[model samples]
Target: MASRRTISSEKGFIEKGDATAFSPAALEKSNIAPAVPPGVIFKLLAFTFAMVVFPIGSYFATVNTIFRGKMSNSTFAGATAAFIANVVLIGYVIVAMKEDQSERLEAEEEAKKSK
Candidate 1:
C-alpha cells in the first residue's frame, strides 16, 4: 500500500505560505459602494419574476379555460405566452432607458450648478 501525505490547511498546494485568507475586514477598509441602486435591483427582480410567472401562468390558464384542454389549441396558448414574455422584456428595456435618461439629466444639472 502507498503512504498518503497529509497536507496542512494553512498552506495547501495552491496556497503560498505568505498568502492570507479573504476576510470582510478588507472590504470594510475600501471606500467603494455598490454601483447598482436598490431601485434598479428591485425593478430587475420584479421583471424577472413576472417573466417567469406570467408566461407559464398564461399558458396553463389559457389551455384549461379558453382551449378546453385541447392539445391542438396548445400552440395558440404558447404563442400568447411568448407574446406576454416579449411585452415584459420591452417594458423592462423602456424603463431602463427612461431611468438612464433621467440620471443623465440630473448629472447635467449638477454639472451646470457646479460651474
Candidate 2:
C-alpha cells in the first residue's frame, strides 16, 4: 500500500519544502467556493434516500410476481408516496434554478442602470 499523502499550506497554496508553490498574484486571480450549497446537499441526500427506498418499495409492491404470490397494499402505497415526493423535490430544484436565474438578471439590470 502507498503511504498517505500529507498536505500543509502556509501562504495561500504554498506547501513547506514543496516547489509547486502558488504566487500571491495567482492566488488572487483564482476563485473557489463550496462544491455545493448546504441546501443542495440536503436535497441530494433526500433524493438519494428516495432512490434507495423507491426500488425496494417497488420490489415489495410487485412482490406478487417477483416473490410470493401475494401483494402487499402498504408496500404499494409507500412506493407511490415516495415517487410523488421525489417528483415534487425534483420540481423544487428546477424552480430554484429559475429563481436564481431571475435574480442574476435583475442584478445585471441594476448594474447597467447604475452605470
Candidate 3:
C-alpha cells in the first residue's frame, strides 16, 4: 500500500497525495471530515455488525451440522471467524487513523502559538 503524508498546521490539516502537496487549512478540512456521506457511516457500521454476527451464527450452524454428521470438519467455522475478525480489525484501524489526525492537528496548533 502507498503511504500517505499530511502536514497539520495551526489553522487545519493539509492533505497530500503521492507527489502532491496542499496548504495547511486545505488539507485539514478534507482529511478531518468524514469521507463517507452521513448516512453511509451508519450503513457501514451496520454492514460491519452483520459481518461479526454472521460468523457467530455460522459457528452454531457448523456445530449443528457436525452433530448431524453433515459437516465433516471445523474449517467452515474457523474461516468465518477469521473473516469477521479481519473486518472488525479494519474498522478499528480506520478509527485510530481518525484520532491520530485530530491529535496531530492539536499539537501543530500549539506549536504555532508558542512560536
Candidate 4:
C-alpha cells in the first residue's frame, strides 16, 4: 500500500519524497547546456574506440614496455594508468550524454501566442 499527501506552500505545489526525480527544467534555462548526440556508424565507432579500444591497447603497450620513453619507465605503472584513464573517459561520456537535450522545440501554444 502507498500513502498520498498534498503539499501546499507559498513557493509552489510539490510532493515530498516522491518517486519523481530531481524536477529540473530545460538546461537552456541554466548556465549548463547539453551537447548534441553523434550520428552514423563512424561517429559511434570513433566514440566507442575512444571509450574502449584505445585504453586497452594503451594498457598493453604501457605494461609490456612495448614502447617506453626511457629505461626508468615502469611497464606495470603505465598499464595501470591506461586502465584508469580508460574507465574515467567512458564515465565522462556517459554522464555527458545523460544530461539533457541540446536543443528544445518551442511549445506549439507558445509559438501560436507569439504570432
Candidate 5:
C-alpha cells in the first residue's frame, strides 16, 4: 500500500509534499517595493532629531543665560523647552501637510494628463 497526500486546486490538484512551492527562495523573488517615500522617511528622522535636540538644547542654553540659573528660573527654562517642542511639532505637521498637498496636486495633474 502507498500513502497519498494531495491538496485540491481551482484547476485540478496539488501535491502536499511540494515544499518548493512555499520556499524562502521563491518568496524572495517578489517584486514589491517599499510603500513609503524616501523623503517622508528623511522628514520623519529630521523631525525626531529636532524634537529631541531642540528642547534639551533650549533648556540648557537658557537655564544659565536667560534664566540666571536660579531654581525659580528653572521653571522658565522648562517652559521655553516645552514651547520649542511644540513649535517643532507644529513645524512637522505643516511640512507633512505641504508634502501631502504637493503629492495630491501631482496625482491630479497626472490624472488630467492621462485623460
Candidate 6:
C-alpha cells in the first residue's frame, strides 16, 4: 500500500525531494530548441562516414609506400569512395544544421516581438 501525506500550505504543496524539479521558478524558463530529432538519419549517416569509414580508409591508404605497397587497385578505389562519401555526408549535415539554426533564431525573434 502507498502512504499518503498532506503537504503543509506554507511550502506551496511541493513534496520532499521534488524541490528542484517541481519548483514554480523552474517552470518559467524555456529555450528555443532544434527542429530535427536527435537520431535523424542524415546525422547518423554523416557521423558514421566521418568517424568509421574515413579513418579505416586512411589507414589502408598509408600502411606502406605508395608505389610499392600491398594496397591493390580495389583497396585504393575503396579508400577513394570512403573519402568521397564522407565529404558528401558532411556537407549535407552542415547545410541541415545551418537551416535548423536559422529557423530556431527566427522563432525566438518572433516570440520576443509578441511579448
The candidate that achieves the highest TM-score relative to the unseen native structure: 5
Residue 74 of model 3: what lDDT?
Answer: 62
Local accuracy by lDDT, each model: 0.87, 0.68, 0.67, 0.58, 0.90, 0.67
User: What lDDT does candidate 1 reach at residue 52?
Assistant: 100
Error of 3 at 34 (Å): 30
Give the winner by lDDT: 1 or 6.
1
Runs off by more than 4 Å, candidate 5: 1-15, 18-29, 69-71
Per-model TM values vs. the true structure: 0.71, 0.40, 0.37, 0.32, 0.75, 0.38
Name model 1 segments beyond 4 Å from true: 1-29, 69-71
- Candidate 2, residues 45-89: lDDT per residue as tens digits? 877787676656665655554445436655665566577667757
CA lDDT, candidate 3, residue 17 = 38
State which candidate, 2 or 5, has the greater TM-score: 5
lDDT of 1 by residue, 1-115 (tens): 9997876665664566432334477656766767998999999999999999999999998987898756688898999899999999999999999999999999999999999
Clashing pairs in 4: none
**Decreasing TM-score order of the candidates:** 5, 1, 2, 6, 3, 4
RMSD values for the candidates in order, in angstroms, are: 5.7, 8.3, 16.6, 12.9, 8.0, 10.0
Per-residue lDDT tens digits for candidate 5, residues 1-99, read: 999765455333253467786789989997588799788999999999999999999999999899995779889999999999999999999999999
Clashes of 6: 0
Candidate 6 TM-score, true structure as reference: 0.38
Candidate achieving higher lDDT, 5 or 6:
5
Of models 5 and 6, which has the larger TM-score? 5
